[model samples]
Target: MPTVALIDYGSGNLRSAAKAVERAAADAGLSMTVTVTADADVVRRADRVILPGVGAFADCGRGLSAVPGMLDALGEAVIRGGRPMLGICVGMQLMATIGREHGDHAGLGWIGGEVLKLTPADPALKIPHMGWNELEIVSDHPVLRNLPAGAHGYFVHSYHFVCANPAHTLARVEYGGPVTAAIGRDNLVGTQFHPEKSQETGLALITNFLTWNP
Candidate 1:
């Protein structure tokens, strides 16, 4: 069975993300071991990794750093080992070079970008972008494969990733102008929206991630 490490560093909707992955795997007729852990050893040993966060960028960053050896373990497992990785919401924000949410906070620098608060050109649009929005896929990335047309992703965030390299942006959604829906490269992929909450579209994304080789 493929082992999946669902990092629990005191900030994310960890259980929901775990259940979503488990359900997706079961529904796809694939068996996977999903371990919700803060243990560095477990993370280092897992075949895949999922990082989920649900708070301020700096807070989440601090929470993640608080776990001893967790940062280095993640680097070993995901970056050096080339294991598949998926970051969700603020978890995805951590992939950026820095986040300018409340203050300037350093991130993983895994992907070249910055997470900045959403500035909708239209005054009426909300800051959180708290509902479903259509995903405009710009690349034929494997994680985005087979998503139905007009596919909408569940979103609730004030900050959005502005990728330094456009090719790293796999999909985008329009909040007021354009917000990054998904960002990815190599074996790493991150979603600004919550797959655990996104109904069919979310499930499809999870399924794709489970089966994606790269």
Candidate 2:
């Protein structure tokens, strides 16, 4: 059975995410072990990794960094080992080169980019870009398998990732304009929305991530 490590970095709803991934694995007929862990050793040994966060980028980044050897473990497991990894919401934002929320904070820099405030063209558009929004598929990826363009997912964030390489963008959403919904490079992929809260579309995405080979 594959082991999926849901990193507990004191940010997001870890239980909800664990339950969602558990359901996703079961529904996908995958024999997987899901563990919500803060221990670096457990994360280092897991076959798959998930980083989920729900708050400000700086706070989440700090939370992740606070873990004694968590960052180093992830670097060894995902970056050096090339294991498949996923990030959700603020977790995804933390993958950027830097995040400009609450101040300029350094990120994991797995994917070269910066997280900036969403600038919706329409003044009437909201800042957080909350609620369900349609996804426009920008690139073909295994994690997006069977998910067609315009699929809706739940979102709640004030900032979005601006990929330094346009080719790294996997999906986009039209808020007041084209807002990045997902980004991917090699074995790392991230979604700005909350897959656990996103109904069927979210489940499908989670399922895809679990079974994705690369």
Q: 37-99, model 2: which lDDT tens digit per residue?
A: 999999999999999999999999889999989999999999999999999999899999999
lDDT of each: 0.93, 0.92
lDDT of 1 by residue, 1-214 (tens): 8999999999889888899999999999998999999999999999999999998999999999999999999999999999999999999999999999888999999999999989999999977789989999999988889987679998999999999999999999987798899999999999999999988889899999999997
* lDDT for position 162 in model 2: 98
Clash count, one per candidate:
0, 0
* Top-lDDT candidate index: 1
Clashing pairs in 2: none
Which candidate wins on TM-score? Answer: 1
